[model samples]
Target: MKRIPLLLASLLLLAACTAPAPSTASTPAETPAAPVETPADPANAGDVHMLTNRYDGGQYTTCLVPSGSYCVSKIDYAAATAHSMCQIPGCQHTTSDCPVLSAGHLLVDGDTLWYPYIVHSDSEYAYALAAYTDDITPPAHPLFAVTHYQTDLVYSVNVLAADEEYLYFVGNSSYAFGGAGPNGAEAYLFSAEKSTGLQAQRLRLDTLLPGQNAYWTLSAAEGRSLYLQYSLFSDNTSGVYRYDLDTRQCSPLPQLTQNADTLGTPLCSPQVVYDLQQGSITAVDVPTGQSTLLTDTFPTGDSYTYAAASFRDGWVLSYSLWKEQDAFTHQFFRAPDGTLTELPQQMYCDARGTTPVNILDIQNGLVFLQYAYDTVPVSSYDYEGNPYTYDTYLPVYGIIPLQDLLAGSQNYRKLTFD
Candidate 1:
């Protein structure tokens, strides 16, 4: 824990008091870890900073933490009038009070914000993006915006991840999905820059692993180290592998995905893979290839619903439900003992409607949802060749109060990628 200076503490005391309480939650047997204390008016703690739904948007995948502000901007839109972005010392925006919207799955590198976007040109859709490194008092926002670059791409692009120096992404030129290789992507990994054209890298693993399938789903990034799901060809071998950007070395994680099927982002930590079903979790000690099973902490198998689990901080959150025909969803929080705490009411809106909320992950005391906003219209023509438009509806981020949800409160807050 960093020490709070006396003078700074004096200035921050009242301000911190006025700030929302630190989000915290504990189960019946274990004491929760203390909430992360945030500093007030933090400046320049620049740190380095995704999913398409069946297409690999990479949501819940992040490594950037705003160091400039003691508390980065997080919001709870439901209590908009009363909610405030976490800005006080000792404050951690892990609750419904902080909503973070990630526009087109944005990234934060130091003071700069980075993301991938599209612009229409002479005859095709050109891939481009912007970055905001300016940290001013009023935050007007532009060090740069929507600067175009030649990616030489013919299909849709997926913005993967960003580090302190480069924005990494993939260019897919394939149309239609098949059960095998190529999958439409022309390049597996391309490192883009603000000043130069996209530089295509063969993942440096192309020859070493020689995977024909070229399975590339970025699971998580920690520091300059990135964890990916790579199925190197040969015996159909597939596992989560860690690639160190600093060293250009790639190693396989056997325990991480040895028998894994449904996968979820590791959220804050990259050492573990949260199994979506079968009530089990696999964790890999990055240095050693040793793996461990944590199925004991999962819900005792239930016939009423099918469930998947996600681990964040100290809590393993899971949700269960029947098929679309069943028409309802249930959420649960598993304590260290696997005891399940079910949310009071059913979640989701019929599993097939204009649902503005999707569960991203769960903390000890809060549930994070991908909250949609800033409606960008997708241009098109209707049956008679008329302009038919609907919002692109990409979710940035949002937080739902656990108490409120468990208590049946319909209100929550949102955070935008500004």
Candidate 2:
């Protein structure tokens, strides 16, 4: 199924008006899918600040900045504030030139950019998960693309996420959809290394869910184990499970918000869990599994239950107050010291209505928003004159230093791309 109705997006954002909080970690918080998603409010449709002429845009994300990082987040702005990333004398980072069409996932580790590339052979398109480093010549690479792994189901597969240790991709039929059993549905895990293109054993996990099957989303990896979550609750569990890359075993983590843990805004680490079931955020001792409640009154408001969001560097917890579909309306981060820092709140308008600002990556003092893009198609050609076409292109996406954004300086923290 061409999942994301818009340009084949994957993993639609999930939020609940209010999911019942379990009394403790063992309780399930399978959020009832928000009422049939309504078209974004017409009022939100009127905002042109983000899609205006002066700004550039790229697919925003909440995942880690390079790869194998955090999930995504969003915010709302009242007006289109002027902000640009740190630019050098001749640095080029705008998404204006659509070099190669992506088969829908990208990962940046250290200096190499890894992506599943789409190739047009005759009339059919094939895909390869490939990598390119800054060491290579620009505008043109050595091969049609560097291949790490080749697969026939490019269109059928979407990357759930990536991190330092592994490159992850999920396809409906690649293996995750191979079959089913009484224990649960079977999903596949295909991992690759970042430094060298090495393939790991393909793991099939029967994450028991109520429905047909369950797929794993890489939440975090540490020491010798990797953490995974289900697109839907897996193996009748809500929190992240520890998956040993070597043993392929799965175990539950009770301290993390297993009741409300989600891929959209997952903990992504073993250190913290946003368990609303206990109505508080807690810090976990990974080795001991002991948790200390960090904050009982996580930022909330009158019409919001203050859904617990993701954690940043295991030191801050992100929360968005949701009235209905307003996942990014108001946000605040809680630190280990029990201090709260609220970022600037702004709202944007589209032809539909006012909507929240799209926040991509949040960590270590930086916040990347899928903001600002030129009014052009994200299409371009490579050195070989191979052409590509994206439904929409991003001319600029804004990156704001968390401190400046909080201080109300509208300048992008500054960056340059080759």
Candidate 3:
């Protein structure tokens, strides 16, 4: 563990003692591993940041821990009076205390906080958004007061995309008497202006693709159009449907070919396709829908299952063509121009890489990555007097400029902005 000064440790303990004790459920059993300690007041840490979410006592609390020895509290309206102090060194003295927030996803636009919330009294979901411009401070006067707006379409709504003009979400409801009957789901597209509260319209996915499976990933395409990636059967030949905004129609893009019949966006657009059946890639034109074949990067006859296609200055695709399931030496490809380019040390293992892999979200030339790790148990305990095993699952969230990824660094500094 990272060494902490005796005085700092005492202060942290005192602060923690004064705060409410947050309880957690027992975790799974696992062998213990040494805790990785980071330096305190770490300034040179890269854009990699860490966020910890602990669901304890029926409430969810998230902490934003920046590089070594820095932790800040996140506050929301629900946690108006909840006081959060840094458990790490240096943070308590320098950074502003975060306010406790209600349970939901926290959206940040340069300190302007927006959370999708449901008005329990009316049981309708609304966007609880707060924007702070210029001089006004936060946790005091959330520029816009809490206003209740309703979209009389569905009950449980999960917002998929939101902008100044429109908000898109998926609403699921069961058919008929709310029994164990078949469920009906719709993709709700809502538009809002300053004068009108919210205008909503629903599009049924089943009606669009009659027999297609549940519509899962809903992403905004160019204006008024949505791209949906959904699974069909247990095997190949799924579909990526484009929902037109003007005509209110869903159609599978004309050029996407099926292999083994499984289909997914290996990378978002203007890129090559990973043919599952042929085990190769084919480039496609978004405008014309014309497709051209490309050479296979992996050894011929090697069935390399594609993982993800990340957008960078170029396309950064993740492919796991393992020689065998659960094998140590797996291959990775970083094809920039739909052409094959090899990377050293392709294989990744749990002891080295991490479980559940990682995702690359490249935004504004900044590359943000989220990864998960399994930590062994230091101790076990009983839950409400019932015996249970315990272990820790740590999730690491960080960001780096796209340049860093292109440069390929062996070392990175941690980022902490409480």
Candidate 4:
């Protein structure tokens, strides 16, 4: 596993799409995944603006300069949008929640950024969204892109695929909602397009164990099929599956391992209750149902806490954390030939009371986050005097690739929503 450095790349302009400029904060800086080229459509032009709010305050938020600027918001939601911070010359103080996207999801569809605003309500699990925009404008209201499928379902989804063609997500259909029991839960796929909007399409399962389920990961392989790891929904068996959109079919790959969760958490938990080591990377052939175990030689001690893993370009990079006593660390690794290459630097602090960090999007060697800096349990300081704290959505960072991090690898799987 090769390490991926968590360093911010210098901002550069490419065509109309530019990298997210650096912010003023010393802690986790705000960085956009990649500059999205806005379509000439007027409806989407306003969608390119970047904005964020302070959870400590009301619904008030600050916007970044449309051209290219950085801003920081206070806990009270008092945001200061400047070309740069007062301290850093040629730098701006802008505010954005674009960097702190929740774990395992990215919203960039082509150039248009689909911001996911997770909705919490009685009968709806809607994600309020804003379209793509260029700068910070007042009344920074996001467009309400609601999901038509409403349920009290217990499904966990991470953004699996996003491109100009469609938006693909993997989640479980709950047995609780119009279900028989726990086994009633099944994996599903949802899609959306710039013209067609959002659509729900249930994937055909080769085996329905009712209790068997799998979460969508960022794992990419060749062909037009998306790879996944599935386990018995209950406390016993485990399996993996691959769904082919071209054929609208699915098949079981293999069972890497299973150590049932005692606490009954989602498929993304970092702990193990049954088998000390369960759930390694498994590749499946969508058409033939063949599969291979990528990493069987598990490491000792603890595995870094990463929300997910993906084979982008030619490398397998997993977002992980390694716990050393009281410190919680986060990093990315290049898993080539079963060997895990740890990134050169730690992406972010995985300490107690630290803000929730998520890798929202990765494109052209840059990572985007829907970051939120909240109250953590740890007390530490960065090089700057400011405590290592996430008061709120401060700024977004547009990272650049330090090295060919995805070197020595294979291609990722592909599928079409049309």
List TM-score per model, in order. Answer: 0.50, 0.51, 0.52, 0.42
**lDDT agreement with native, every candidate:** 0.38, 0.39, 0.34, 0.33
lDDT of 3 by residue, 234-287 (tens): 233333456554455666653443432333342133335566656665655443
Local lDDT at 159 for model 3 = 31
Best by lDDT: 2
Better of 1 and 2 by TM-score: 2
295-383, model 2: which lDDT tens digit per residue?
A: 77655344434334443522334555656665554455555566676656453433323333455545555665644433344578878
Candidate 1: lDDT of 290? 61
Task: Write down the lDDT that model 4 would get.
Answer: 0.33
Judge candidate 3 against the unseen true structure and give its global Cα lDDT, from 0 to 1. Answer: 0.34
> lDDT score, residue 209, model 3?
24
Off by over 4 Å in 2: 1-97, 101-105, 118-127, 133-184, 191-200, 207-211, 231-236, 239-241, 246-257, 260-264, 270-294, 298-328, 350-367, 370-401, 408-418
The segments of candidate 1 whose C-alpha lies over 4 angstroms from its true place after superposition are 1-103, 133-163, 170-188, 192-202, 207-212, 231-237, 257-278, 281-316, 319-328, 335-339, 347-400, 404-418
Instruction: Summarize candidate 4's per-residue lDDT along 1-418 as a digit string, tens digits.
Output: 1111111111100011001111210111112212222222122222111112212211112223332332222111112121211223333333332332111122334445444434444554544444534453111454433433654333322233543444555434444134344444444444444455534543423224444333333233234554444433333343344555454455544333444332122232121222125534444333344544544333323453323344232233343344555544334544335555544432233343443334333434443332332222445788877777453323332222324333522121111010
Rank the models by TM-score, top first: 3, 2, 1, 4
Ranking by lDDT: 2, 1, 3, 4
